[model samples]
Target: MNWLVWALLLCSSAMAQEHRDPTLDHHWDLWKKTYGKQYKEKNEEVARRLIWEKNLKTVTLHNLEHSMGMHSYELGMNHLGDMTSEEVISLMSSLRVPSQWPRNVTYKSDPNQKLPDSMDWREKGCVTEVKYQGACGSCWAFSAVGALEAQVKLKTGKLVSLSAQNLVDCSTAKYGNKGCNGGFMTEAFQYIIDNNGIDSEASYPYKAMDGKCQYDVKNRAATCSRYIELPFGSEEALKEAVANKGPVSVGIDASHSSFFLYKTGVYYDPSCTQKVNHGVLVVGYGNLDGKDYWLVKNSWGLHFGDQGYIRKIGRELSLNLGKQSFIPLILLVRSQCQKEESLVNRRSVYKTFFSCMFAEFFTTFKLKVAILLF
Candidate 1:
């Protein structure tokens, strides 16, 4: 190689480094603002020791968001800027107790059933506002309560916000739940059934931590008899279930760094897995520019994902995650007397038996005499 060519290449490399220094400083400032003092301090150490290649990849992908017009999703540095993929998984992913899933339970419905092209429970005034799970791993509780809230709105003509705190506190190890550490949606449902009902978010409130079960009987607002698990590996069944049965609680692999820093557009992580780690709610499904996507409601606050929602592509199973999704259906009980709908045989009358009192009046001579005597 000529001396002139070598000099030019070295000069270009120097200029590239100079350009990236400002961008790195900008990210450092964002990191300090997003996290608290403790987090900031820990991340400062992590950031300085971060791999150069990873930072470069992040900057490259973010640059491609604007440089490439055909890209479906946008990525940038967010709360997960400093953490590695392993750290993200340890902190965020929390779904557990898959081995305890009930056996002999048959999904009576067909997966091939036709479903509507688009459906959103929020439009029908069933879904509650987006919620944040905070620093705790209480996503299972949030997902459970979200499904219950939707069912309550459907059962009675009232949209009530159920409490995730109730599940976090009450559904302890006794019910096969590990509180904020990790839990299953079905276990939460069973806890609700065993403990009469769950309280409203207004009365109970979310503390985002594990605590003693301080549930008050008077505060009970809604109850569920049982919950069902959708047919494993059947996206069709999941779609149909969400369309007909309000929102369904689902588990996904939210361990990717890109998933953590997701800002907008349809998110499709090729590295996502079907191991079922994070719990979220599936509210609806729709298509965009020939690409079908599931409208997923996340518990990471309004700032995360697409306003706490993500559009998972319909089918582009390149990596191991594939298109297989895990979904569990929770059924709400109208009242106690209403025998828990016959889920076993799939044939039972689910009627609301209401007790009423009435007063009668009569002008007849005999009736008037009896009234006067009484």
Candidate 2:
């Protein structure tokens, strides 16, 4: 039989059965047993394909099945809606994330700090609240604009939501199929900076459907005048930028089921290290149980993370490997205090001042010599 045909047959067999909690409906077990032979025979190849494609690792699938079983067991005990602490713990424990980094990896001391409550207004409340991108892989644009929006609010004290569609359609530095493939957030940031800034969502609404780029100079889709790169993905650098300068752009590994399944608080999915899909911003950081973690704001939606925030600890270096390699690229903006401070604080200040005076004295002396020669 053709592999495609066999795969289709297996999928059809699995889809034919309804998935219900066995405890809620006792007949499910009997149904499973009756159809078990036929189901296995039909879907064995399909299961193998899923395993070979790395979409469904054996251990992870096993854990998911175990979690479902426990859910069924809880339902039998009339604790369906309200799971016991032990039961909840057991279900959580059954979560097996493949491609987890070794627990013994050494961690550097994180120099990042928390965002002041005063500046909390700059954070992206949720990605779901913003326009959707559908199947378009313009996640990088979404992330870049999302961070820029917050940064603008932080710097200007004005809350104006920017458009991701603008960056998707307008950016020329990168290439992809209608923004459906992928691109880097850094490139998008640079595009925004060079172009002045992007427009407000109201000015240029998002067409979740892909279309031709209609560049309207009047509305001028929002743009940024500058981009300040940080010294690596230091949470401290991010916090300092937010507190002192403005909100910063950041990237992270978002291509995991755990990211989609995130409910509340910090999520440390061992699987994040495997597939790094999404990029986001680190707006804040906080200490939990004497351990420090970043307050990552994602562009997926409010349903993801702790209301759109993920706490990542310094120990989990695997998820933030790219951040560790960052070389700070601060946009040079003229600040009088910074400029004056730079001149007065350097080691050669006295030397530079005396050298300028000595040059002036020589020019005066040389002018007299020239007059004498004439």
Q: What is every candidate's alpha-carbon RMSD to the true fold? A: 13.1, 15.3
The C-alpha local distance difference test score for the whole of candidate 1 amounts to 0.66
How displaced is residue 121 in candidate 1, in Å? 1.1
Q: Model 2: per-residue lDDT, tens digit, 164-277?
A: 777667774353223434555656766666665566777877765445666565665344434544554454555555555444455555544444434443345465553344
Candidate 1 local lDDT, 1-374, one digit each (tens): 32322443445444344333545666665565765424323323433324333644774676586467746677655544555666555545577745545453334455566778888888999889899877667888888888988877876667888889889898987877887778877778778888978999999998878888889978878877567666666676667778877788877777777777776666676667656777888888777767777778888787676777775544333112213333556643454334344333334343322210001112211343234323
Model 1 clash number = 0
In model 1, the runs with Cα more than 4 Å from the true position are 1-23, 34-70, 110-114, 315-326, 335-374
Candidate 2, backbone clash total: 14
| TM-score per candidate, chains pooled | 0.76, 0.55
Model 1: how far residue 49 lies from native, Å: 8.6
Most accurate candidate by lDDT:
1
TM-score of 2: 0.55
| CA lDDT of each prediction against the hidden true structure | 0.66, 0.45
